[model samples]
Target chain A: MLSLDHARTILDVVLKTGTEKGFKPLAAVVLDARGAMKAFAAQDGTSLKRGEIARGKADGALAMGLGSRAIAKMAAERPAFVAAATHAVGGSLVPVPGGVLILQGGEVVGAVGVSGDLSDNDEICAVAGIEAAGLKADTGA
Target chain B: MLSLDHARTILDVVLKTGTEKGFKPLAAVVLDARGAMKAFAAQDGTSLKRGEIARGKADGALAMGLGSRAIAKMAAERPAFVAAATHAVGGSLVPVPGGVLILQGGEVVGAVGVSGDLSDNDEICAVAGIEAAGLKADTGA
Candidate 1:
């Protein structure tokens, strides 16, 4: 189980890295394995809808059981399937980088998603945050 | 048709009432008649997902043309109907108290939803806020 404390820790590290790197105001979300929101926040200057975007990224990865990078690749190769999958998840799937599954002992525990900067930069922050929490980040890279 | 100012006023009053009454930390939202969010705030100590629940309450009311209190009653008396209705609304319809319609001159202008305590107490704060904004609160009771 991904505890709330772990989620909070991941969120804090992601936000801290974003601020330090001077990225656009970022939104981060942590979702437990059950796909329930564990923690989420958008920096004060973030755009209005970024929080939902962050959530979408995390949920998409979980729904497909792959990192968002993999989902993005799949979407590019199969747009129709990806579109249908998005609706199947209540439109909570954003096929983009920054959604990385959290792993412990090679088992999925949860996911962390970040949004605001370039997709690649967002993924970097997510990976860093997961590592900071002493967990492995499977970005499907 | 409520403006952002009206939404903010309703949100403020709801939080104030909840705090003064010693209820749990609350999340409140205001949605205009078009069902677009105008304002929202969640107290610091609110648990995860309360913000979404608050939004669901207001959105459910606006979608069904009835306050959430009435929706809860319907959900109990006709579980199958309520289940279908929930799917029709994209699963945002949380059949519970705390969603109240904002009425002015007998016209529904918007809605307020509060969550974070007992459902009954949540409803009270929502009602107090709508009335404080000089609009009538129709809880559909």
Candidate 2:
């Protein structure tokens, strides 16, 4: 089970790293299997729009059972997938970064999403969040 | 100025209340100055579709400078306003009770929007959120 405490730890660690690296990031969210929030955080300077972006990424990962990067690649190969998602979710399935699926003992458990920084930075923070939550990041296919 | 801390506090209190009261809720959002998100949360067991409803309520409140309840009334009275909003921000402004404007020291700093519960229940959560954030809950004109 994805614990809220774990989500909070991931958020804290990611935000701390962003601060240390001087990144002006906005919001981060972690969601459990039920598609509900386990943890969520927004930095002081982050904007509201970032909230939507972060959620979109997280939802994509949760829905597709893969990281958002893979989803993006799939979107490229299957544009209809993205189009259908846009219609089905009312423009929530943005093909962006800051989303990662959480794995536990080789099983998918949850997802973490970050926004407010560059895509690379966001991905780094998301990985950091997963690490802080005491989980290993599956960076390889 | 609205702070992410306040937004998080509102969501925490409101969601806690929802769980205690046995209300089904899906999404919640807090908006700061310039109508951006300070924090957002989607609770467990909520449909991913509820996110749009949550953000739409907050956007409606911010756009009209009133609680979503008032916007609901206005929408009933002047349907044009609803159409205008729909055209304005990609139909992101949904006039409903799930939204509450945050008033700090007699000024509007932000708004809160909730979804997945009954409209009345959503309103109640918004009120609780605003109060929890140390802001006044303006439910009416």
Candidate 3:
């Protein structure tokens, strides 16, 4: 189970890393293994849109049991399928680079999503957050 | 203007109220005036569905400028209209009873939604959360 404490820790790390890297203000979301939101936070300067985008990316990664980078690759190869999937999921999925699955003992424990920077930068922040939480991040497909 | 502090306070209140009432573990969502998620948390043992349902209810309330209870009534009266509205909003609307609009100084600041137990109980929790956050619950149509 992803504890609220862990979620907050992850959010803190994500935000701190983004700030240290001079990235844009960011929004981060942590979802438990069951795809339930454990915690969410958006920096003061971040746009409201970043919140939804971050959550969508995290939700997509959780639903597909893969990192958002992998999902993005799949989307690139199968635009039609990705479109259909977005429609099918009521527009919840966002195949992007910022969502990364959190692993513990070789099992998916949760996921973290970050937004408000370049896609790759957002992904790097998520990875940093997950690692800071003492969890493994599955950034690769 | 709903701040992150207010959103987290609201979520805490909702979860605490639900636990005190012996309700099932609840998931709660707080959305800013722009219909952006400000904070979200799902208590341990709650299903992931609760998270989505809570978010959907809050999103619906914000979009329609009405509480979820009012939306539910409207859905009952005009199912087709409600369906069309849901589709129009990309399926974010959930005409359910757990969503309540948050009012501050007679202005819509944000909204709160809870899910887990009976619909009425969920609504009650959301109201408690809003009130605990020193805001008014605008459940009236």
Best by DockQ: 3
Task: Quantify all predictions' global Cα lDDT against the true fold.
Answer: 0.84, 0.78, 0.87
Over B21-121, each residue of candidate 2 has an lDDT whose tens digit, in order, gives: 89985578777867776766676557756866887888888887888888888889999968887788677888878778889999999888888889889
Model 3 agreement with the true structure over B38-68: per-residue lDDT tens digits: 8887777877577889888999999999999
C-alpha lDDT of residue B114 in model 3? 82
Which stretches of candidate 2 lie above 4 Å from their native place?
Answer: A1-6, A20-22, A31-40, A47-98, A117-121
Query: How well is each residue in A1-141 modelled by candidate 1, as lDDT tens digits?
Result: 676557767877898899899898787888877776665656655666777788889999999999999999999999999999999879999999999999988889989888999999999999988998899999978
Model 2, residue B46: distance off in Å is: 1.0
Give fnat, all candidates. 0.00, 0.40, 0.69
DockQ order, best first, reads 3, 2, 1
The ten-residue window of minimal lDDT in model 2 chain B covers: B39-48
Candidate 1's C-alpha runs over 4 A off are: B1-54, B58-117, B120-141
- TM-score ranking from best to worst? 3, 2, 1
Question: For residues A55-134, could you state the per-residue lDDT of candidate 2 as single tens digits?
Answer: 88888877777788877777789999777976786666656666788889988888888888887788888898798778
Instruction: Write the residue-wise lDDT of candidate 3 on A1-141 in tens digits.
Output: 678778878988998899899999888999888777788887766785888899899988888888999989999999899889888878988898999999998999999988899989999999998888888999755
- Under CAPRI classification, how is model 2 graded? acceptable
For every candidate, C-alpha RMSD to the true structure in Å:
6.8, 4.1, 3.5
- Candidate 1 vs candidate 2: which has greater DockQ? 2
